[model samples]
Target: MDAVFVIKLSALGDLVQADGALRDIREHHRHAIITVMTTPPYLRYMQRCPWVDLVFVDPRASRFNLVALSVLRRRLHKQHIDLVYDLQQVGRTRFYKRWLFPNGSWVGDVPGCSCYLKRPKGAAAADHFAHHLRQAGVSVCHTLVGNVGWMADDVTSLMRQAELQPGFVLLIPGASAEHQEKRWPHFAELARHLLDRGYRVVTVPGPADLAVCRAIPGDMLVPDDGYYDLFVLAGLAAQARFVVGNDTGPTHIAAHLRKPGLALFGGHVSALSTGLQHTCFSWLEADDLHKLPFAKVWQQVEQLMGKDF
Candidate 1:
C-alpha cells in the first residue's frame, strides 16, 4: 500500500485502540504512509505517535456542513489516499468517507458500538476494530504499542521537576462523561494503601477531572499543569512502578506502555472493551470490589508487584 487513512474520532480509550491498529499497520506495511483522521482534542496524541505519517483534525464544523465537507474532500483527493480505515464508523464518518474517497478501499465499522448506557458487552474496542480490518484483508493481531518515544523527553523533564522517587504508584480516577459509571471511589483508598506501604503516589487528571484529583490525599503529588499533553501523561505513567485506575483511556495507555497495573471494572463496561491481554494485571468487577475487603485489593497489588510483569 502506498498510503492509508484511519478514521477514529474522539473518546480517549477508543483513540488509543486505534493507535494500536495503526502500529500494526505500520509493522505490516513498513513503506505505507499512514494518515489518521481524528478530532482536535486527540490530534496532539496522534501527531506524537511515530506510526502515523499525518494527522488530520476532523473539521470543527458539523459533518453536515457542506462547505467544510467540500474542503475535506479536496484535501483527501490531493493526498491520493489508496485505502481508508474507518475506526469511528458513525453515520457521519461514513458519509464523509463516501464524499471524500469514493473509490478508496474502506475498512472498519459501519457504526461503532454505542456507549455503556446502551450497556454493550465488555470487549476491547481495538480487537473489534482489528476484526474489521481482517475482513478487509489486513492480517494482524490486536496488540498495544502504548505510548513510548512519543513523550519520553517530556516525561523525563516532568519527573525531574517533581523530584519523583522510585517505587511510586500512579492513581488515575477519572473517565469521560459517558464512562463515569466505570470510575469508582476506591482510588483514594488505593492511594492510601500505597502511601502507607512507603510508596509515593502521583495522581494525574484530565481537564475535567479536578474534583477527582482533589480527593486524593494532600501528601500525594498531583501534576500541576504538567499533564496538559497526553504523551507526557503517558510518560509519567511509564515512570510509575505500576498504575491503578478505573477503565479509562490512560489506564489503557499504561497497559500498552507495559506498565504493570490493575484495571477496576464496574461491570458497566466489559473485559472485551480492553483486550484480554494476559500479564501482570488484574481486572476486578465493581460488584466484586464492593464485596471484597480492602485487604484483598492490597493483596492483589502485592501479587502484581512481585511478578516479573
Candidate 2:
C-alpha cells in the first residue's frame, strides 16, 4: 500500500480539523495507506478514527533538532511514504519536508496573511484544508466529516467514577491559551441558573482552565488524567443534555459530535471558526453573550433540552 504522511502536531482543534483532510484522502484513494504524525496527547483521538491507517508521534524536541529530524526521516523512508502533506506548514514542517522528502510535493496553507483570507465563512478548518488538497489532485466532498465512533464504554466508565447522571448540563469554562478569553462571569451565572433549574452542572476544565472550574461552586465533574483523550471527551459530551462553553477545543469537539451546544463567542472568535451546523447555537460578538443576562443563555439551554418553559 502506498503511504501518505499528514503532519499536524498540536492544538486539539487543529488536529480535529485534520480528520477531514484524512477523510478526503480515504475517499479519493481508498487503496493508499494514510498515516498521520501528531503529538502524543492526540494519539488516542487518532487511534479510534478509521480514516488513518497509522499514526506517528513527533517528539517534544525542537523541530530544528537534527537527531529528531534524522529519526523522522528514517521512519518515513522505512515506511516508504510516497507523499508528505504538511498540514501545520510551520517553519519546522517546512524543514522536515525539505529533509525527508526533498523532491516530494508539499500541500499546506499559502504563505502569510493570504492563508487567513482563503478560508471561507461558515466552513470548518478541515474544509479549508480539503480545498487545498483538491488543488493537489485529491478530490473530496465539501461536507465536513465529524469525529468517528463513540468511546462510549470509556465515557460510561468515567461518568460512573464521577457519579455523573443523565440530563446534566456540561460546562467547559476555559480555552487553551490566554487570548481565547473564557466567558466565566457569564458561565458562573449560567451554572448557578442551571443548578437551580434541576440540572446538575458538571464542569469539565482542561489543565490550563482548572482555575475556572474551581471557581464554580458545587460538585463538578472534571475528567481525571486517564480520560483526557478527545474522543473520550466527545463521548462524554454526547451524554450531556446540553454543552455550554467558549470557542475551545472541547466545545468544537462537542459540536462536531452533534451534541446540543451553545457556544459563547466574545468579539474574538467568530462563528465561522467554531460553529457546528446541527442544533448548535453561536452567541457572537454582535449577540454579546458576555453582556447578555444569564436568563438569555438559560432560555437557549431550555430550548436545546426541549423544556417548554
Candidate 3:
C-alpha cells in the first residue's frame, strides 16, 4: 500500500474512542504511509499520534465551496490513495467517497462497499469498530491501549506550584459543550467527599469546563490560564491514586491511561458504547445524569480507591 487515508474529523472524544481501530491500522500497515483527515481542534492530539503519518485538516468550507472541495479532490488524486478508511462513516465522508474518491477502495459503512463491520446485537462501539476492521481483513483485537507520551517536566512544575501530591485524585467534571448533561452536577460534592476522606482533589478543566470548576465551593486548583495541555493532563491522571470524571475527552483519556478510574455516565449514551476498555476502570450509569446521587458515586470512587482512600 503506497498510502492509506482515514477520515475522522472533529469530536475529540470520538477520536479518542477510536483508539482500537487506529491500532489495527498501524499494525496492519506498518510500512505504509497512514494519513488522517481531522479538524483543527484535534490537531494537537493527532500531531503526537504514533499511528498516523500525515494529518490533513479538512478545509472548513469544503461542504458548500465547490472550489475548496475541488482542491481537496486534486490533493487526494495527486497522492493516489491506495485505500480509504471512513472511520467517521457519516454524511460528510460519504460525500467524499461519492464525489472525491469515487474509485477508491473503502472499508466502512458506505452501502455496497466491499467491507462493513456488522455490529452485533449488543456490541460496544469500540469492539464493534474493531470487529468491522477485522472482518474486513485487518487482524485487530477489540481492546485498545492508548500510548500517550506525557509531559513529565511540565506536570512536575505545575504539580509543585499547585501543591498537588502523588496520591491526589483527579476530578474531571466536564463534557462536550453540547452534552453538558453528561457533566454530573454532584462532582463538587464528590470532590468534597474525597477531600474529607483525607485525599487531595484536583480538577482538570477543558475549554467548556472552567465554568463548572468555578462554581465549586472549596479550594481547588483550577487552571488560571495557559495550563491546558493534554500531555501534562495525561501525566497528572497517570499519577492519581484514583480518577473520576464525566464522559469527556479528558475523562476518557484518564481512563485510557489505565488509571484506576470510574467513568460515570448518564442515560444519554451507553457506558459500554463510549467508555474506556480497561480492566482497572469501571463504568457507572444511571437513568439520568442528574439522578446519579453523590452517595452512590462516592461509593464507586471508594471502591476504586480502596486502600488509597
Best by TM-score: 3
Clashes of 1: 8
lDDT of 1 by residue, 1-309 (tens): 588777878877776656667777777677888888888888777787788889888765677688887887787788788777676766677677556655556664433311111113455566565565565556665343433435444566656777885557888788886766766766678777767777888886777677888888623344554445566677777678888877787787777666788888775666555663633456666554445456667778888887542
Please provide, for model 3 over 1-309, each residue's C-alpha lDDT reduced to its tens digit, 9 standing for 90 to 100.
679988888676778777767878888888999999898988877877877998988866658888888888888787778988888877887788788877778887777676755456545657667667767788865335554433222478777887777878788888878886787888878877776877787776766777887775444554666456777778888778888888887777776666778888888777777646533679889888898888888777777677646
Where does candidate 3 stray beyond 4 Å?
60-62, 118-123, 141-143, 149-154, 217-219, 222-224, 275-279
In the predicted model 2, the residue pairs found to clash are none
Model 2 vs. true fold: TM: 0.80
Ranking by lDDT: 3, 1, 2
Clashing pairs in 1: 116-119, 122-270, 122-272, 122-273, 123-272, 123-273, 124-272, 124-273
List lDDT for all candidates, in order.
0.68, 0.67, 0.75
Candidate 3 local lDDT, residue 231 = 75
Kindly list the per-residue Cα lDDT of model 2 for residues 1-309, writing each as its tens digit: 777777878787666556566777777768888888888988877776777788888775666587876776786788887777777766676666556666665565434321222456556566567567777777766326655434333577777887887767778788766654556356777777777767778876667777778888555555454225455666777888778887777777776666667877766656666425422544434344457567766777777668442
Which stretches of candidate 2 lie above 4 Å from their native place? 60-64, 109-124, 137-139, 151-154, 157-165, 177-180, 217-219, 222-231, 275-281, 286-296, 299-309
Q: How do all the candidates rank in terms of TM-score, highest first?
A: 3, 1, 2
The TM-scores of all predictions, comma-separated, are 0.82, 0.80, 0.90
